[model samples]
Target: MSEWRGVAQGCAVIVGVLLAGLAGAGIWIAVYMQGDPQPDVAKAARSHTARAADLLVTAHVDQQLAQLRTALPWATHLGTTVADICETYPANTGFTRRTWTPVMCTRTGTAYLAFDGDFREHLAQLDTALAAEGWKPTNNAGDQPGLVADLDYTHRPPGDATAAELAEAAARPNVATVRYTLPIPSTFAVPPGAGGGPFPIGTVEVAQAPHLPTIDDGTAAHDLTLETRHFVDWQPYSHTQLSTAYPAHGAILAISVRLPYNT
Candidate 1:
């Protein structure tokens, strides 16, 4: 009888083990059927999140484009007006091919303006104009709304300085100065405010040869031809291409030449 009881107990133990195995199998099957067989819940969530973010960005971009379209006409008109007033070409004789748009200049273009003065006077005047106009210098991309000014100027020190010395001077910390060159509309001439000439019309750009790498050759062979242009489109006047090498950091020096009072 003891032997028979022991056999029965053994049988019961085997049955319990089998039942537990079956139960576990069933649970696993149920989980499998529920979904996510591969079980990459985190990845799926990330994909969905990425799609949603894309949609949001697309919507906002469309809205911004719409806004820009609405304001386009006024902006164009302003540009035309400025270009007309500050005709890129110097009003006075002797300036060739408009505001030194290109990097290199012929000997005549780069030559000193009379024995009495250099380019600093124009820079100072431009700086004054920018301040009066309430424009600030900047170096942002063109797509964004702002002005892009390209400026370059070089100072010839007393006596001959070695290339190393010149390079040092070029790299020295810049003393920020306001510089502007602009075309004043015909409307702003002949009053208490507008008397002498074309009132400053565009942004000001005051920078050295290295500062305007686009224009600066680093050769120091030629006289410094301060060549900078204001992208007076819709954007505020600023340094637009400091990041690019071919375009160079200070290629387009910026200045905010203010509009003279309209008579």
Candidate 2:
């Protein structure tokens, strides 16, 4: 009986030792499966960078729109409408290939107010206003009948580096550059006798750098750019009887801002 008790105690000790070994092995395997941590750190860095870029771009866009609102109160109309007509045709062979051409026509109309008085004076006024805000005239085609001036401004955002770190890390390149045009007339050409032909249209454009740095390994960076046309007033006569009623004014703003990484 004593020998049997000894054998049972020994068996229990062996089982405990085996269980402990297995638990340790499991832990080691789990740690090994986790792989390198550097990739995760890089991913976090990219996410931070993208978020920073997006915030910078949004602020810049808002500033541009605000300036526009102040400088051109007459530009009350700002929106866009699109019309598409589709027709079907039989397939045909051409150049040893058979294909059917898509039958669709899309028309977009934008309207906005131009300066009511001397356009040149208005342009000068706008230039002065923008100049006060650090914008400069990159090109001036004011002599042209329809086009006026092109203004450009560069803006840099605060860097991620701490103040104690190298200033070079904090000194980033231009995060974004905005180019806007001041036109004497509208971008749209109203048909003869259109009710709203007298009003001028103006346009603004914005373009910014990508959210992430371009990689040499063939990865593409996400960028942002957009153009908007602000109209003076609506034109009801331009629409056909079957068409929907035109809004009170005609304008369109298309804005796109892209960020590269997930948070």
Candidate 3:
């Protein structure tokens, strides 16, 4: 009888250990599920970004594009729309915070003519038109690499131009960049209590920086496969550009204008 009583006590001890293990696992899972709380500034920045995106899509994008189209009547407006670019901030507190702010937008317009030919003249006209709209060319300080703030198409070698220059001049669908700094009021305005003053957001290279939207179309642009179809919102040019293939004479006009605040 005493041996049977000892065996029963051993079984009870095993059951007690199993029950404690299960309870500990449950507690651990609960703690893990309740991730670290976000900072108030992070929350404010996200909200501000959303509001800025909405304003760009609803009011600013069309208005600005209209002005541009009028300025460049020969160029076909491909697509232009604001996207919610996700930005991640790593914290030393064992968790990473992700937020979207400093909203970005990209525009692609094309001319049926060659970039090194008649399009060069048109671009100079565009510079003048943009200046009227408060966009000015940056000096050497803010000039971006591989992109020129002021394009000098008339430049020729001191003597006779080389064969490379001759071929480059006649190359179809070539690219020329013209950088401009526009003081965009949209980026400056923030929600109350955001705790940031009026300062320049710095140069925003939309193509290089910012994670593109998750949406994919499985289309190929040149050798690379472009999953995100440039436009994130349903703007006037979205549907037409998505359906249309880049024309044979299409001179790709990539514009990366940063709308930072005046410091």
Q: Is candidate 1 or candidate 3 better by lDDT?
A: 3
Q: Please give the CA lDDT of all the candidate structures.
A: 0.31, 0.33, 0.39
> Which 10-residue span in candidate 3 carries the lowest summed lDDT?
204-213
Q: What is the Cα-based TM-score of model 2?
A: 0.28
97-165 in candidate 2: lDDT tens per residue?
333332211122222222234433544455465555544333343332111332111221245645554
Q: Residue 47: error of model 1 in Å?
A: 59
Candidate 2, residue 79: how far the Cα is off, in Å: 3.7
TM-scores, one per candidate: 0.22, 0.28, 0.44
Clashing residue pair totals per candidate (backbone < 3 A): 31, 12, 0
What is the TM-score of candidate 1?
A: 0.22
lDDT of 1 by residue, 1-263 (tens): 99999999999999999999999988976665543222232232235443343244333323322333243221111111111011112322342222211111110000001111233444444334444444343434223223221222222333587888788656653323332233333322322423344433233223333453122211232223322212211222112323232222222232222332110
Error of 1 at 12 (Å): 99
Local error of candidate 3 at residue 154 (angstroms): 11
- What ranges in model 2 sit over 4 Å off? 1-46, 80-115, 140-263
